[model samples]
Target: MAVAQPKIDLAESLLSRHAAPGPGARWAQEARAAAAARLRAMGAPVRRDEYWKYTDPARLTAAELAPAAPLEPEKEALYGDRAQLKLVFVDGVLDADASDALALDGLTVEPLARALATDIHWARDLYGVLEARGQDPVPRPLAALNTAVAGQGVAIRVSARVATPVTIVNRQRAADSDVVLHHLILLEDGAEMTLLEAGPAGARYNTCLEVDLGRGAQFHHVRTQGRDNERHAITHSFARLAAEASFKAFTLTVNGVLTRNESVIEFTGDDAKAHVAGAAAGDGRFHHDDTVFVTHDGVNCESRQVFKKVLRNGALGVFQGKILVRPGAQQTDGYQISQALLLDEDSQFLAKPELEIYADDVACSHGSTVGAIDEDAMFYLTSRGVSKPDAQDMLVLAFLDEAIQEIEDDALADGMRERLAGWLARRR
Candidate 1:
């Protein structure tokens, strides 16, 4: 009998096909090669992997690409009225022709390909360094693959406070496109910025973003992932914070065929703070997952995680979050909560929340809940002359409002609220 290939070996085999080296400078080439080697050593995630047990990895790791049509989202503009700088990308390649001026007054934007050149840049040092550091305690083969084969992306550096938000808009056009993009962002000491993003890139894509915040720096990110429900994506955001630095990120996901967003953060300086929140909605045949890991190594640091998801029509939602407090992390305050609303009997939600603390004195807590909609509230709304569909939607949006309100900026928060309302309108 011919021996069947082991699942681990098969997984590695599939990743190898996507590992062919791309053109770049010697340093960039070497970095990619090293990352690819690490990915092979770690092997691709399979159903056997504990972290991937809830969702099948076969769809994401298959050797052949899936066919997908480009999406036009004229009606899905979330921040259309905002007067912020804009950068455009098509199929993961920076569309210079479509983007505004590359050089702003206080910041510089350049293609990530420059890191491959002989001239040394901060990006060259950070290209895959943060992702490599995050591999410990958990192996991320996808992140490693991105470092090794990412074809195009952008490099942004901020030295002063940016009054205008910078938006990265993605547009996909081609069937069966496979896009790998790696983004690098550096915020110097005392710098601040707000990043706005909206779009669905392609049928299949892998994206890795690395952000390094210097002492006393601040970074705010708000994103919407509602358009083009057919896209499948795997994304990783790795962030490192210095003393007194702040990082806040919020994501609003509409329905999608498959999506897994992972965020990993580490506090290396004392008094640093980080907050992450997400609100997602799904219909039948949709699958969305959020996996987050936050580590507190600095004394007096604080972190928070709040996630809310709504699923109906047999859709599936997943959340896996953890907070780790190192030995020296006394006076640390960490909180986490994950909750879901199942609108129908067929809808499903799966969540895993954790806390690992080695510190002697620290306050850390986590909570998870899954339940159906409240009939009493529904009855009250309907009795007030509100139709059932509208009443249910109002309740659903109210459930998501808590997470959305976390955005500090009033304008940004209002924009997100409008998007949520539009989403409910479409569902109606």
Candidate 2:
């Protein structure tokens, strides 16, 4: 089919602004070219698109980014006290001086640029591979753009169980910075690792992360998007799990003018498990969206999607999730839930949950709810001496606890809870 004229023009215009990846291996160059071609064919997303109808893509795909003032953190950086190998990126560019050495006993971490430059590397089979696969059933043009032009990010490979977590710290120093980053992670059979991310990447940021897990591998991820009220960002995570592999990820979002996160997971091996969850808090002028698609291609695979958002003062929240069980994917177990706690009458929550099952011997369910704080519970708390604001904060925490509990690490979960409490306290 011929590409739409407007879509071709938009893709060309965006590509003209950025240079292609420079001096990479032949395979890598071919991958980049393929991605650019894909973007042009699909075009950038607009409010008219089915998945993007709730969240406008105008600001995210504009030719130029509006300046955003960097907000200084009022508290210490998340996961700063934990024992981890940290890599710092200032304005989306790697800052070697501020980052610890990339070397680890059981892991190999390097810049994406260098990884692509090498002719023979394991990343050849994984980078951009998962993102390309995720394009089916839905087109993600932004992620395709990132894969084609992004020159900064990390590529990690794990061979054995890694005790220390790997953290990527992003800092926005320029008010008008626009960034595009892509990361790849590959785990060998029986390998295990945890990945952490924190900070506001840039005034306008687009990032894509691809993970490929071998049989019996396990990967855990936890991320906290910075509280930059004026920042705008769209992030994508594409993961493929093999037999008996496990993938778990959780994200906590505070304040941002516009933010959207998308996750696509495919179970290629029987008994594989994947869980994707998030908790978001948005106030006036804020918008947050979470979209997830989980495909069960293997028998007895399990998947879960849990998301909770608290919106007030006219803030808007959106959630779109789906589970697909292929014909031969018998005994598949899938669960999905998205809920919103509206603190005021002006706030809005939109949710679309779906299940498409082809196998007869599978269990799948989904639920979404939007409501206000319990007035009776509020009255009881306030009557017992808790201030109105404090009581409300407590209830909000309790409401979000389910999603927060999805994190596998206790210490990380605690840090997330404390951070949520601090955000609430500051607002009060």
Candidate 3:
């Protein structure tokens, strides 16, 4: 249950010798120092740790990591053309000129650095919110590492009875560098919002996003990871919902050498709802993992999760999901499913689903399936005048469309479908 002391000592020594907290590291003034101490105390997680048995982080060394830097003026154009409200962070440093704030009513968006200087109470309360509640051991090093050196991110609040969408685009373009830490937080109350996050890399990227929803609030988050072949990227998302609130998150990954998308969601208020869904297409030696943890802590809360993956070439796909219902969470309704399609014998898929419940009144179930292309279905399609490659691609798309079709946004779904289709063509 604990990492070895020698590893902790070594990590601490290396971190102390090479890493220093960034300028204006918010949440806690000495957060990096505090995290370094915590890492020293907790050490790194290993395979023996049940939570980390599947994915290992010990292979990642300090030498493999590098601090993020500021973005250039010319590169700012990439974000401006894609997003309406853009906040750019280069190597963990906020670029004020690259971001143009919107003066929309009932919506507030500002950089975490600025907010920390002005609103210390909110910043302090937000710091370590996720760290204090984590149960896994694998992320101990990552959480501590990110907490210690997280640079400028964002904090946005949508007022009561309001509806607004906030889009965040993160770009990592370091051709020869280390790792970049990106943090983002979104809070809404009786409001509706959308967060569009894009990570394209030529570097290593680790991003942590925290979202809090108040009563009756509705939030939609779409994340896209399309980094270069050599880039390594990981995203950690933590979300909590209040009474009658609805939280929906969608993720699509088509790139990255090694990418992991981890999400932890909690329904803490009665009648709260959450839907977590993702689709990934991997090829050309890419390794992608999607992990989701959902907890029902309040009576009458509900949650649903669906993940689909398509792997080709020598690519690998993994999905690990768990749903827990507490003793007091009566009438909790939770469902989870993960399915993967292997395009070739060299391609691979791993799906694991778990359910732990202490409530007798709760209804929880989980399912997973891993298989190759259905030859009968493909032949049926080919007989209907469909080309061999096109038929196979169509069947793959149809299998994954069940999850994507549940999305409420038509334009977003269409765009994601197009991207998946293009990737399938390349696979063929």
Which portions of model 3 show Cα errors greater than 4 Å? 17-19, 22-27, 30-34, 65-83, 136-140, 160-164, 182-188
**lDDT for predicted candidate 2 compared with the true structure:** 0.92
Give the winner by lDDT: 1 or 3.
1
Q: Pick the candidate with the highest TM-score.
A: 2
- Candidate 1 lDDT over residue span 295-393, tens digit each: 999999999998999999999999999999999999999999999999999999889998999998999999999988799999999999999998999
- Badly placed stretches (over 4 Å) of model 1 are 1-16, 19-22, 76-78
TM-score, per-candidate, Cα-based: 0.95, 0.98, 0.89
Which residue pairs come into collision in candidate 3? 32-148, 66-178, 66-179, 68-91, 69-90, 69-91
Error of 1 at 311 (Å): 0.3
Task: Give candidates' CA RMSD values in order.
Answer: 2.5, 1.2, 3.5
Clashes in candidate 3: how many?
6
Give the Cα error of residue 113 in candidate 3, in Å: 2.1
Q: In angstroms, what RMSD does candidate 2 have relative to the true structure?
A: 1.2
Model 3: lDDT of residue 112: 62
Q: Write the per-residue lDDT of candidate 2 for residues 272-327, one digit (tens) a residue.
A: 99999999999899999999999999999999999999999999999999999999
- Model 2 lowest lDDT segment of ten: 71-80
Runs of candidate 2 with Cα error greater than 4 angstroms are 1-3, 73-76
Error of 2 at 149 (Å): 0.6
Query: Which pairs clash in the backbone of model 2?
Result: none
Per-residue lDDT of 193-249 in model 3, one digit per residue for the tens?
Answer: 777766453266656677778888988888767535555666777788889999898
- Please give the range of 10 consecutive residues that has the lowest summed lDDT in model 1: 1-10
